[model samples]
Target: MRKFNVFIVLFTLFSLFISEKAKGFEQAGIYSAKIETNQQQQRIYGTVTDQNGETLPFVTVLVKGTNIGTTTDENGIYEINVPGNVTLIFSYMGFKDYEISTDGKTKLDVVLLESTVRLGEVVVTGYNTVERKHLASSIESVDMERVVSRPIIKLQEAFAGTVPGVTMLQGSTLPGDVPASISIRGISTLQNAEPLVIIDGMEQPLTDVDPNQVKSINILKDAAAASMYGSRGANGVIIIETHRGTTGQFKVNVNSWFALQNPLNLPKFVNSADFMRLRNEAYSIQGQPLLYTDADIQSAQEGKTPNTDWVKEIIERPATSYNTTASISGGGGVGTFNLMLGYIEENGLNKIEGSDKFSARFNTNINIADRFILLADFYAHRLKVDRLRRNNDGHGLYQIAWRMNPTQGIYYENTDIPNHYMLHNDMNPVAFINEGGTWNYMYDK
Candidate 1:
């Protein structure tokens, strides 16, 4: 009986202890719920703009002392959920960081100021890279964004009307021909005035470069700017730098454009009747017999004569061209890579003349031992050009076409050789173009 009494007393004490613990837990739960109810989450919205009142996209907006963050959209708008009395941070490239306190308010708009110091901008010269402000010589730099904006057949064509004191004179419309005679600061020398072109420290023709892979192009106009090249800097210097991968996430870019070309401001040619009258007048003035008889002139006036528009026959209408480029770039802990592929097809005003180019480039930078960096660049391209067969005298078909008589027909009624058209004065422009066969020149680099 004594043992039973002791057991009952212990049981009663244990029950009382359990009840006190349950009450404490209930009070703690109520306190936590009240705290959570007081800390209400409010939606914050704002726009980020630059000092010039321009919307700044891709700006990073973050809540202070927390992992919550968001980026501004293309329209510079952002929304976030955060507690009161918290601060928001805004940051972007080339701009000063901005911070605003919520202070129990929901909406906050910010205008970031531009960084005053621009010494970080670097320009690549042939020998080395220097800060743009520190460079003492006259150098003009063009970035890839500007270079690839236009539909250009050759790299040299990108300089048209863009570079100061530079003139690009296109002498021929033939495909794959050297684009234009590039003159910097007018004629710098009496002979051989072509500027020296350097691509990644190697002398190369601008035509061989793929504009899609270019990172930047710098032109050294003054002797001091190009003195490193010695005698090659007499005329001027063009330094081209290809793109290299950066240390970040992977990126892909695709660019394409289609264009049509037609002859601009072409002179109007005389009709058959007018041509005959002019020929007769020229013959009479030169004390020679009339080339066309009265019957022929009458027949031409009556639209019975076969008068072909030679220019129209030789020149193709609405020549079409297209260019496409795709590039992939990425970087990791120790290495980075960039690969680009490009294709271009340009048809000339002449049916038989056209050019196609295929190009590939790979650039890589490997960090060795966290100290040394190894950079490798590989580029290759194949260019195929189709042109007319030139005469033995080395005159191009277009040149001969200009000298041919407008009154002649493209073909003859009878010929000894099968599938061969008649020749006029040892040359027939149309027949030569149609029957001379195809001439293709291919170059790989």
Candidate 2:
């Protein structure tokens, strides 16, 4: 009876101890699970700025060692949820990368500095990218942003007064004409002093290219810098780099402009009465009869119907021009793409002369197995120009007007030919300009 009682007491004590220990373990596990759930997630907020105290938009903020990331908004603010112990990375192009530990904090503000290493400032040469400081030659670079901000029709027009050692002699203000005669370093040779122009490793006229598509323009002003082209580089060299796609999220840009132009520094001409009187005096000195009758001179002085001001009749005022461009660019791990489209319409001071242009460009880069890169660039443009015939010569319509007798009628009542005007030298400026005097040029490339 004593042994049985002792065994029961011992067993009951063991049971109670085991039950209490198991309950303790269960409470500990529940507490551990609660702590883990709380630490698994955290809401973070931050702002990013540059060294200049300017807020940086579109900056990439990423969680380190994870696929979770978000971009800063236009206001340079970001919000993300991440693990408490993880690190946050802030990155931007042309700027240094920055990192910070969460350290149980929920807000982080960062400022990134521009990269300082001069070796990374690359200028595209003919064959490769050479750093600006390392090049052992004279070179000048023009920022594309400044060039494109100006409202101009031709790409070459942007070079005027912007580039050093480049003289742009603009011959005429006519639409669709070559913008200027470019002379590099002041007339190196007597014949063909124009520089050799290279656009994206191809030789083509810069006038055909859209200013919006240009990324950079570099001028190699010395033999040392331009010797890569051998004999062709004697005049100098202009290397143009076009914009390309970058690996990032998709983006689109659109730009449009409208401009009005007026004719500048036009010659002042004498009235009909003064011109005729001067002519008669010269003719009289040479022992010749007077060209104008007494009635004609009286009519001219009184502002009669025969007196003509040819300059006012020919030129139009407030010439209008417009251009619009749009581009889309994006990329991924596999490849990148850039597409652009543009349209331009320009009217000259002379109503009969005008031009219109349409352009499209596609540029793509594809990575082949992380070893080879396939690059494809395609550009096409259509240009149409309507101009006046014989206006390109010295003895054109303007010259004809100087010698025309204003007393003559624009149209004769007894003329057999259709639309024939009665005039001196048998050449009427109005008749020539209005009748079959327009030339149309269409170009496709």
Best by lDDT: 2
For 1-445, candidate 1 gives per-residue lDDT tens digits of: 2333443455446445644654465456445644875876678998899878899887877665433567789999999776557778787878887888888688888999998757437877787788888988888876557668878878878888888878888766567777688988988764478999988777888987778778788888888645787877878889998877654335666677788888788667787888999999999999999999999989988877768677677775578787777676755435667877777787776667788887878888887865687888888999998877763222476577766666777766467756566578777777776777777899999
Worst 10 residues of 1 by lDDT: 1-10
The best candidate in terms of TM-score: 2
Clash tally for model 2: 0
Give TM-scores for every candidate, taking all chains together and pairing residue i with residue i: 0.71, 0.74
Candidate 2 local lDDT, residue 4: 32
Q: lDDT score, residue 435, model 1?
A: 74
C-alpha lDDT values of all predictions: 0.75, 0.75
